[model samples]
Target chain A: MERGTQPVIKARVHVGLKAGVLDPQGKAVEHSLHALGFAGVHGVRTAKSFDLVLDETDPGKARTTVEAMCQQLLANTVIETYRIDIEG
Target chain B: MERGTQPVIKARVHVGLKAGVLDPQGKAVEHSLHALGFAGVHGVRTAKSFDLVLDETDPGKARTTVEAMCQQLLANTVIETYRIDIEG
Candidate 1:
């Protein structure tokens, strides 16, 4: 569909390090937060998000497309997890 | 609110390498995809996503809170960008 022809739907996807995976970057951030006086912070895991604008369509189909995108290109299932959100 | 008392809102966040950013992992993936016969794929940038379950409330407020979370903890503004999605 053309970009402006249809209602714009926004999809947000989040991928993060799975539990039991080592994240040196997250560990460094946690250390920094602790040094910055942020207490009560036990663990810090890092994640990512993607905001996509697509033509309005079937939510189920769109979700399936996105899930495929995640599996094929967006996420590393070996170390990360993903979720999707669609809004008009 | 208690976990079961409130409607579960799912938030997905995607973070990725910005343009001009170096991504060795992404480069490796691109190479692999090319070897696997996926042509027409020029540049590959890797990204991350997060799936969050939250208590239902005002969406605007929830978004603000999530934005803060992204800025403060979820994403690295230095090299990554993040987007949030909330669904009930």
Candidate 2:
């Protein structure tokens, strides 16, 4: 970590439930919205996005690193799918 | 809801902790990742995204509806900020 070096790489990981997986939280949201009179709303699902700032400089490496992170920690692959977007 | 009518509108609402807000969950996640050998990672923040499927056809109205959802239940406005993305 040197002074005046390349800016930190940013990785956005979007983690979401897989199709057909039951999501009680999402169901609650749909119900709440309907009770609030937003009857047009349906199929509400909850997901998570993580912003990771990493010291990696190469975009390819950064994406690979973050994808590993998602697989290891950020996402539950059995019931979730994740997409990684990287920018320097 | 007519058969084979206009496609459902999709809205993505990203809810995040405001700057200067204390995020224990984010800190814990960062620590966990570092413990697992991702030492290069830093400034890790966690955010929630909501995917809403609506019967509404107009993108503008769809955005408005989801924004209202964020203000009312999707986010804690005092400590959170949200961005809405709408698509059909």
Q: CA lDDT of B59 in candidate 2? A: 84
TM-score of chain B of 1: 0.80
Give the per-residue lDDT of model 2 (tens digit) for B2-81.
Answer: 32675678788989999989888889999999999999888888899888888887888888888888888899999999
Best by TM-score: 2
Global CA lDDT of candidate 1, please?
0.64
DockQ of each: 0.15, 0.87
Chain A agreement with the truth for model 1, given as TM-score: 0.81
Superposed model 2: Cα runs more than 4 Å off: A1-7, B1-7
Top of the candidates by lDDT: 2
| After superposition, candidate 1 runs with Cα above 4 Å error | A1-3, B1-88
lDDT of 1 by residue, B1-88 (tens): 2355654445666777778998887677557656655442334455765555545466676676567667887789998877788664
- TM (chain A) per model: 0.81, 0.89
Task: Estimate, for each residue in A16-44, the C-alpha lDDT of model 1 and write its tens digit.
Answer: 78889987776776576566554423345
Which residue pairs in candidate 2 collide? Answer: none
The TM-scores, one per candidate, come to 0.51, 0.90
